[model samples]
Target: MMENVVIRTVSRLAVPFIQIFALYVIVHGASGAGGGFQGGVVFAASFILMIIAFGTANVRRRIDNRGIMWLSVIGITIYAGIGFLALLMAGNFLEYAAIEAVLGIPHLHGILIDLVEAGIGIAVMAAMVSIIYDISGNGEESS
Candidate 1:
């Protein structure tokens, strides 16, 4: 899939903007249609660009499978932890209001939620890239 020139070029060109947009989406999720899942996939596209451009070896060197796995786990943990914290505060799971209370600024609830979504995005991107790299066999294994 990454072999196509069009895919490679588009992915490369769109990488940065996609990432930025992803952040925007995650942050504005409460007010908009985007969220953690959408942003994470967008974030992962950057790495996908790297893999397509330089091959799997380069991507692997920059981000190994083990590291990606840990990252994914950590991301999930963070998301869950945040939800738990909200629950502990007597709010529904993942309730941004609880987070706002903790931060002492109710208005910042959206910001905090966005942060968590970003984390999830990071994790998803890592996991997806890792899977793609693994399947790609780290590029042509130099002679």
Candidate 2:
């Protein structure tokens, strides 16, 4: 584990900013550059930073295997739920137009799209963290 106070302090300070920027990227991705995948990757980087500073044990304590599983499930559920809802509304899978029409809300498509992106971001982040943990071979599973 990195014992350097400077590096640990810097990582601790930068982690939140990195995560916030990741969310920004995910949100802004709808109209311009950046998107779910990028933002998810950025969010995963926060955990990576933590691992680098404190080691896998710390990361595991914060997010165990079960926690990772829940995150993945929740993320996928969010995405699939939105898609199935659109289907229920008699539109194609993931068709936001039908949702917009049914919801009768002005400017809802963008928001729904953002929600989907958020789900994607969450899923990707979880997957990446899991992969990192696995690759690191950080002893046995915590849970």
The best candidate by TM-score is 2
Write one digit per residue (lDDT tens) for candidate 1, span 1-143. Answer: 54678877876788788778878877776677988888777777777777777677767787777788888988888888888888988789989797677668757776667668867877777778766766778355322
TM-score of every prediction relative to native: 0.75, 0.94
Q: List the residue pairs that clash in candidate 2.
A: none
Error of 1 at 47 (Å): 1.6
lDDT of 2 by residue, 1-143 (tens): 47799989999899999999999999999999999889999999999999988888888888888899899899899999999999999999999999989989999989989999999999999999989988875468733
Error of 2 at 52 (Å): 0.6
List the global CA lDDT of all models.
Answer: 0.75, 0.91
Off by over 4 Å in 1: 1-14, 99-104, 138-143
Off by over 4 Å in 2: none
